[model samples]
Target: MQRRRLLKLGIGAAVIIGVAGAGIALIKPGLVDGKLGPGAREVMRAAAQAVLSDLLPSGAARDAALQAQLARLDATIAGFPAATRKELSDALGLLGTAAGRYALVGLSIAWAQASTQDVQQALDAMRLSSSNTRQQVYHALRDLNVIAFFTEPANWQAAGYPGQREIP
Candidate 1:
């Protein structure tokens, strides 16, 4: 009976956390009507830096790459179906807020203010966390960053994927 009760309680807590996070997103809104509302770029930029650390070039080259990657990500996301876009927007919005950042990302610092190492550790934690929600969030961010970075043909070499040859 005790085990069953604890299981119920655990499930309930998870649901509450999920709902509260969604509530924060609803109030602050990651995107404004299927668009980048505010702080979304910072969130994505910081995440990309950490997620693609070794993959990005050094110094000024890295900065330029990030800008280009972000642009590509923005354009790609814009083309997504409305429902997927809204969900992504909501997730980004949640990460932008302090509550969501602490709860989902395990970081209290603002995305722009966080060091790449710090963000990387937080992402690692999310990846290793026992919570399914945390793992899912990590995957979403990781996949998005990876996709955004690789969309540019110039980056293919870095990923060991040479540009495709024209059909004969």
Candidate 2:
């Protein structure tokens, strides 16, 4: 009876260890501050663009022009190999606070120019959100509108735009 009890105790300990190991194995690794997978990166870029476009002027000409520019950016990304995309996305994930500030500044300016009061509020909150907080990032894009508010061509050029047609 003593030997049987010892064996049962050992079996129970082994079962507990096996269950714990299985729980750990079920979790996918490689997540940095809850940011993971190619899909998350893609979603972030898309959300950023949507927030920015809302601050642009609602003119057909500006819409067409910005569409052309975005198409170019998309084409460039599409040209990258899968490995290159992964490398670049990883690098973007690892960017420091200074780079994050620059990115936020550019996006904020775009949002200010094109977005409504609601969108501006959302963008402001997002800019202040903690980098590691994916929930905040996701929430910031919750009620975003995808409109493009824009200015005149001359005004646009004055914003230091590097267009082929120089300001006369």
Candidate 3:
């Protein structure tokens, strides 16, 4: 009886999440015609701050770095195949919405208003969630931020990677 109840609860939760994700994707997609729309950028910007809290600089430099990271994120996501891009874009769209944020990220506040600490805590929750879906979301967001920030040539040095040398 307990197992049956748990199975029912899991199915119910999955359905709710699917409906919410689909609604967000239809109402306000994160990407459009291969472009990184505002919705996607908002989610990426917030997630980057959370994932790179320690690595990102402080004060004005941090603001500049975040802006640059968003640009990098746009370019990195653009390179993904259409299907993959669409899936990621939809996930970002879901995260950008208020209901989606509360459901998936555990954040009740808007991304624009969320402090780094708030976002970090929410991400930590997602990382530790028993739900595999939430865990996947955590990894995807973290990996995306890491990839976007590290892809810059200037950042390569900081990560201990010297630029490629020209072979004679």
Q: Largest TM-score belongs to which candidate?
A: 3
Clash pairs, model 1 backbone: 30-93
Tens digits of per-residue lDDT for model 3, 73-144: 888888999889888878888887888888888899998889989999989999999989889999999999
**Positional deviation of 95 in candidate 2, in angstroms?**
20
Candidate 2 RMSD to the correct structure: 14.7
Worst 10 residues of 2 by lDDT: 143-152
The whole-model lDDT of each prediction reads 0.87, 0.42, 0.86
Model 1 global lDDT (CA atoms, 0 to 1): 0.87
Clashes of each: 1, 12, 0
Q: Give the higher-lDDT candidate: 1 or 3.
A: 1
Per-residue lDDT tens digits of candidate 2, residues 66-149?
A: 554344334444565776555434433422122332333333333224344544454565666675343343343333212111
- Judge candidate 3 against the unseen true structure and give its global Cα lDDT, from 0 to 1: 0.86
Between prediction 2 and prediction 3, the one with superior lDDT is 3
